[model samples]
Target: MKYAWAAPGAKVVCVVPLGASHDFGIAIDTVMTIAEVDTSPLVKCSVILRFQERPSDCWYAAEAFRPIISQDDDVAMFKAIADRGLAQNGIHVPSSSPEHA
Candidate 1:
């Protein structure tokens, strides 16, 4: 499959059984804001819960709670944390087969 595009973009689509739906589509919009983050100890990335369209729907889940991400499935020790949360909230992540070529 080939896609013709003009700019770089990233998105994650979640298919849940039943729950409130939200998206950050405006992330690709026209906005040039800058800031600095203190990555002194280490840069552990995490997905933040935020409502980009509504200023009232924004806040940190915790002062320090980072999820571990990995390319290998065996390295997914922390993946179940989010998976359980989703499952309990009536969300289902479709099972995927290992890709081999």
Candidate 2:
């Protein structure tokens, strides 16, 4: 998947660098940032990611990860209804809270 499509809080799975053992499977993590790096002739951009159970950050090539698409129809329908209601009521709210800033 393209690195530009990745967003913070999006779920992704590592597919590259299978490591020493091939028996193990892919690792999943949440995207933190598409980290900026010096341009090079031989290397691609890297992405910063964090596992929910891990405290440290990890970096991997953008090509090494794939975005996870949600398959929950109920959640999608609920979000659509909520959005429609807000729009019909002329309500507006910030996407993020001030505490996050």
RMSD of each: 16.1, 9.7
For model 1, how does the per-residue alpha-carbon lDDT over 27-60 read when each residue is reduced to its tens digit? 3122311111222234343323332332544422
The whole-model C-alpha lDDT of candidate 2 against the native structure comes to 0.53
- Candidate lDDT scores, in order, read 0.34, 0.53
Best by TM-score: 2
Error of 1 at 4 (Å): 51
> Quick one: RMSD of model 2?
9.7
Model 2 CA deviation exceeding 4 Å by range? 18-57, 73-101
Query: How would you encode candidate 2's per-residue C-alpha lDDT over 1-101 as one tens digit per residue?
Result: 34655655556666665343543333545333333322344544544444443333433455667766667955787878988899899997555557866
| TM per prediction | 0.23, 0.37
- How many residue pairs clash in each candidate at the backbone level? 0, 0
- After superposing candidate 1 on the true structure, give the runs of residues whose Cα lies further than 4 Å from its correct spot: 1-74, 99-101
